[model samples]
Target: MTEIPAVENAITIRDLVVDYGTRRILDGINLDIPAGQIMVIMGGSGAGKSTLLRCILGLKKPTSGSINILGTEVNGVRARDMHALRKQMGVAFQGGALFSSMSVAENIQLPLREHTRLDETTIEIMTRIKLDMVNMLPHEHLMPAELSGGMTKRTALARAIIMDPKLLFFDEPSSGLDPSTSAELDELIIMLKNSMRMTIIVITHELDSVFKIADHIAVIGEGRILETGTPEQIRASTNLEVQDLLHRKARETVVDADAHLRRLVGEEE
Candidate 1:
């Protein structure tokens, strides 16, 4: 009998917590994303999904817990070490976050130019290659203002992959797009995972895209991880919060009467 190989994690998060003033954003998050796979972190609005992403990216300092990305501990990592770690990671923000002033090619080439000492011709060639990979080669000279929503997304994706990052993080990738465009982006994400062999972490609430692209799904609610599993497992989850999120049903607010009264009387500050 042949034995299966052990899976390697591209990221490991343990007891992750984040807070703003007195509001605890993330309670305790423990997650592991396997190498060369797509993991989708999903939740409703204010569920701490974005906060978790920020912590993993080393953008926001967590109140406690550990975040290890690409085998390097992110918490309390030195500035220069964190900078080095970022070279192995790529992020596509919710709004594409492309500069309105730069053309598509220039936007895609920005990372290489900033991080490397490659010649101008080499940078141009690399930029075109990335643009071609995202099917935006023909629009390389087009500025961000001239691009449509789908085009803007593709350009951002092109830029994200320019450095061939080991890990790719996409925030709300399917947001604000028509169904067709969103589906196209979904396909592109899978293709990137297959072709680049990079671990991809997507933060989204779009059920369709989540099911389509995720190898694993972590459902979060009220600053807690409600469940984590494959799409089928998630669909079959018994947890009410997970089911509500999956079925698009509104969650009932369970108000604590005493706490509510205390806050109303300014006694629980």
Candidate 2:
């Protein structure tokens, strides 16, 4: 990442609200991610976790609120400024998102090629270093389809950090892997944080992965943050919804017959 003034928090979000047409997704969210810490955002399906990630990633605009990433407000930053700021960040998308046509080395080199004016030799050296970091150097010549799921994830991780991004984002890093593979990936995540000192934001609901890597965890539900704390605090939380989620218990929704009918008729607000 580019040299910038140091700050206590890498990301600060306040009164963030996002809506899609008539339905609200994120309602009144406030969060501060401390610098160089691993913050995990976990939630059940349709819990607005992904929506909030989008807002922070600058992929979508919110209905109302402010998002400060790396001390720069993202809502209306100048185009050039935003470009510069984004150079400090990187995202490892879900399912790897590697181009099927590109080799692993090529994929990792994409960012450097797009962002910098380095020569081919330096870019090649950088790409190889990243691949070695992720234990993917041996497979650098393979295409996306030729690699296993774990290999794919490792390659994506290498690409995310190839630029030495100040803030790194991971989406479902352990999603499709087996137990042992997941554990290995979790270890790599911690090792990277320790070695690189990059502030990482992981969006995942996997409990084992969460316990292993997260410095702090935020539980989101129903388009809002339900709780934010250390893993132990989250485990000890007294909130009914939190407990339900932690135990993987099915939510019991009591019926309001009249209100239900009204909602079905588009009458409930």
Candidate 3:
């Protein structure tokens, strides 16, 4: 018998809680995301998925517990140190959040300019490289408003990876796209994971996306994690909430006239 190598975790959250006034948005979240793996946070609407992402990004302070990312405590870090810590992450917002005023190339170059002392020519080369990575090199001169929804999303992804951060966070990567387009995005995500070897945490509810790309998933409900497992594990889970959630989308309709009639007659009686 051979012992398996121990995997290193990129993120660790223990007893995490977040409160907005009296409302508890996240309650005692405990999660571990292994290094260089694509982990997904999934749930229905208002399930605190985004809150958990924000907490991990250090945008929101935890009321209790700890969030350790790349061996640094997120909540307790100093402001200057926190800024440095944040540089290790790349985030893609839900709406593609690109600057309407800037060309795709300019938008991608923004982070490089801010963070690096590289000359203009070097930044241009780096920007083009990232755009090429996302297959948006041809659209470099186009502005956000000039691109299609899918292209805009790809451009946002290009900008996200321009700095080559250690961690990548995506908010609803497949939102507002047709099934085929969504699937395309899924393929792109898979390619990014393999090529970049960076830890990825995506907040999404798209089942197709989840099944396609998630190495592990944390299902959130009522501001807490209901379960965390691989797609196969989640599909075979006995937890009713998990079952209902995973199956509801695929449930078929069956006529039950006799049952309906019985209930109606019982009510009359």
Candidate 4:
């Protein structure tokens, strides 16, 4: 058997907690994502996967604990410093969150235009390079609404990698794609990891994609992690919650049906 090589830790979290008023979204979470590897976070709907992604992206401040990305503590970094940190990161939003008013070339050029003093010729060259990398160069003149679902995703990815960010995040990469398109996106993800040497974090409940691309996976449930391990380890996990999520089975559908109905009827305290 061949032994896998270990990489340095790229993102580390300790005792992470997030809350909304009295409702807790993440509870005492801890994780370490290694450099130059793909880490997928999988969970059922409302299982706090998106909240955790937001916390990791510095979009939402956690209620407590630490998130260290590329050696900088992210809990309360100054705005100037946060802006600097963001320049090193990129996010591919779910549903291909491209600008409605911009062409593919324009959208991909937006970041380089805003962040760098690079001239038009250089910016256009960079945009073309990324568009080619994502196999979207042919559609650079198209608008967001004119692209297919997979094309939209690839275009969004082209924009994400335009700056060659050290850390890249993707949310629901294959959410609305057909099976073949989803597999193609999965291949593209693996190629990005192998060729770019980027520390990638993906948030998805898609089991097939998770098993296909994740070097390691963290299974989250109800604001907490049930297990974190390699794809094989996760597949072999005996934890009920992990199994439930992987098999798309609800863990507790009627645990409190009468109380839930009473609450809907305004009869509960």
Q: Which of 3 and 4 is ahead in TM-score?
A: 3
Q: Compared to the true structure, candidate 1 yields what TM-score?
A: 0.91
Query: On residues 133-229, what C-alpha lDDT tens digit does candidate 2 reach at each position?
Result: 8899999999999999999999999999999999999999988899798898888888888999899999998888887899999999988889999
Can you give the TM-score per candidate against the true fold? 0.91, 0.89, 0.91, 0.90
TM-score, cand. 3 vs. native = 0.91
Candidate 1 per-residue C-alpha lDDT over 1-269 given as tens digits, one digit per residue, 9 for 90 to 100? 99999989999999988989999999999999999999999999999999999899888999999999988999888999999999999999888899889999888999998999999998898888888887899999999999998898888888888899999999998888998999989999999999999999999998888889999999999999999999999999999889988776322234578888898999998
Better of 2 and 4 by TM-score: 4
lDDT against true structure, model 4:
0.90
Per-residue lDDT of 245 in model 4: 77
Error of 1 at 171 (Å): 0.7
RMSD of 2: 8.8
Evaluated at residue 145, the lDDT of candidate 1 is 95
Per-candidate alpha-carbon RMSD to the true structure: 8.0, 8.8, 4.4, 6.8
Clash count for candidate 2 is 0
Residue-level lDDT tens digits of model 3 in 1-269? 99998879999999998899999999999999999889999988888998888889888788898999999988779999888888889999999999999999999899888888999888988888888878889889998889988888888888888888889998999888888888988888888889888899888888889999999999998888899999899888888898887776444223367776787889534
Which residue ranges in model 3 land beyond 4 Å of their true spot?
A: 251-269
